[model samples]
Target: MSNKSEALSRRFEAAFMPNYGVPPVALARGEGSRVWDVDGAEYLDLIGGIAVSSLGHAHPALVEAVSRQVATLAHTSNLFLHEPEVLLAERLIGLLGAPARVFLTSSGTEANEAALKLAIKYGKANGRPYVVAAENGFHGRSLGALSLTGKASIRDQFGPFPADVRFVPYGDADALKNAVTAECAAVFLEPTQGEAGVVPPPDGYLRAVREICDTTGALLVTDEIQSAIGRTGHWFAHQHDGVLPDVLTLAKGLGGGLPIGACVGFGDAGTLFAKGDHGSTFGGNPVSAAAALAVLDTIESQGLLEHVKTVGTLLAEGIASVEHPLLKGVRGRGLWLAVVLTAERAARFQTAAQHAGFLVNAVQPDAVRLAPPLVITAEQVTSFVTALPALLDEASHD
Candidate 1:
């Protein structure tokens, strides 16, 4: 580490909580898909702030939008309406191809929390008491969203959560059918489980779940925080299965790099939350909303959805073709991928990749996640694939 990086690390440790552990490198700045550390060493940023940097770093459109919005008007509390927030909500609802009402928030957790409150209200009105979620599916970390998350490692420690939340195995329609009853108020699921190593459900799994929810009178809430915004070569991952959710939660890539989230409710689900049912102090601030609108507009004008499909295939196929003993295969779709290792050496693999001037995430014990910027070029994908064999070899030796 450089002297400056070490100094910053020490300062971070002194000032912040230790929940994230100590980062390996202190990043100074980024452009496109590359970031430079404080020591001036450049690394390809494949994680993209865990799928939050949709347009890469410092893109012209995002920069101009945020700069202009901040200079004009930044925050207008929900007490009064703002043009940017209204435009953003309209754009999101139009993308979903549904008649929906939006409740904007500051993060994915808040979005899910809003969805949970909507579900609880629906349950109270309908005399249902239970909410079903998928095992190993991640929603968010707030107390309410955490109650719906089924990951044991994170959820176990922060217990005494809200009651009547049941978990069924992901990708198993029969299991969900047996678990969701008439008394279930909602079923919260991830179209693709991002934190669970970018695990995609089986074919037609979402359709089956939709049918089950329809039969049981349970609202289907698809948490698309990690899978939306052209991450999976689609506007929303559930759309790939031709399924429409009653309540949809989104964030992560919504504001390009800014903090924002939305909980969109369709049909009757949209009307459950009346005036003053819920609100956020800084949910749809003008700055974040402007950034989000720029992201959506750029994605459409630049044809990034098709670009994601083409480049994602190249990256996935390139990693799969590498004849490395430590590589098991690749999983997930589009740019949201997980390099499955043959063994539990993902941490070592991440360290090795960092040393080799690339940034990836050890999302699990045996999976390294890659959710790069939507603007990442085919050339960048090739470069990463070319370096994979050696990185895997180093991790094996380590």
Candidate 2:
């Protein structure tokens, strides 16, 4: 770390909790898909803040919407109605092509927590007592959300959660079918498991899960927190399989960078929650709502969804063209791809990529995840791909 970076780290340690440890670089500014550290070192942000920066940094639409909304109206505390909040909810439901009720929150885990509560209530009323989730699936760290998560390492440390939850291996249709029984109230899954190295289930897996949920009279809850909002070339990743979930949890890219989350319930699930059943203080704050609106509008107007598909394909091809022994190929949809590596060199590769002026995430021991801004250009994708050979070489030696 540079002197300036070290000084910032010191200040951060002095004033902040040590939960995240200290970051290697202290970012000073960002524009489009690039960010600069305090020491003036620039980098291409390929991870997009873990798939949250949908429109990239300092986007005009987001800036204008937030600035305009904050200047006009910012908060209502869910006690009063706001136009931006209502409009955002309507827009999201319209995108889903369904009639649903939304419970907006401050983050994705909170959304999942709300969804779990809804499920438990609905199930308790229906005489069901168990919830099923996929192994390696990440919901969040809050107690309830953490319980629903299937990762043993993260969840086991924080338990015991208040909910009775079961886990099945991800993408295993037969295991899921056997696990989700009549006693199961809900089955939670990700249309595409993002944190598990951008893992996508087999084709027809979601449909099978839906069928199982239907047979067992259980609600199908899909966590679209990381895969939704055009991250996977679709508004909702489950839509690619032509299925609608009973409950959908959304966050990450929902506010295009602002902190926001939503638990959207469809059909009977939508009407399950009555007044005072659930609420949030900053849920759907006008400014975040406006920012979300800007993000959706920008995705539609600029045709970034299609752009993501095209550029994402280009990137996959570019990266695959390299014949390095370290390369294991890429897997994912749209901009959410995992560059597979042959060895347990992912953390080293991340460091090398950082040194090479590109940002990526080591989501697993052998997977480097790439979820760049939706506005990232073809040239930027190509640039990252071209830099990978040398980065891999450095990682190999390191």
Q: Which one wins on lDDT?
A: 1
Off by over 4 Å in 2: none
- TM-score for all predictions? 0.99, 0.99
lDDT for position 164 in model 2: 96
Output the TM-score of candidate 1.
Answer: 0.99
Which residue pairs in model 1 clash with each other?
none
Q: Which digits, one per residue and each the tens of the lDDT, describe model 2 over residues 1-398?
A: 98999999999999999988887779998999999999999999999999999999999999999999999988889889989988999999999999899989989999999999999998899899989998999999989999988888877877778999999999999999889889889999999888888999999999999999999999999999999999989888998999999999999898989999999999899989999998999999999999999999999999998999899899988988999999998899999999999999999999999998998999999999999999999989989988889999998994
CA lDDT scores, all candidates in order: 0.95, 0.92
Q: Write the per-residue lDDT of candidate 1 for residues 25-79, one digit (tens) a residue.
A: 8999999999999999999999999999999999999999999999999888988
What local lDDT score does residue 20 receive in model 1, on the 0 to 100 scale?
A: 82
Native-to-model Cα distance after best TM-score fit, residue 255 in candidate 2, in Å: 0.8
What value of lDDT does candidate 2 attain over all alpha carbons? 0.92
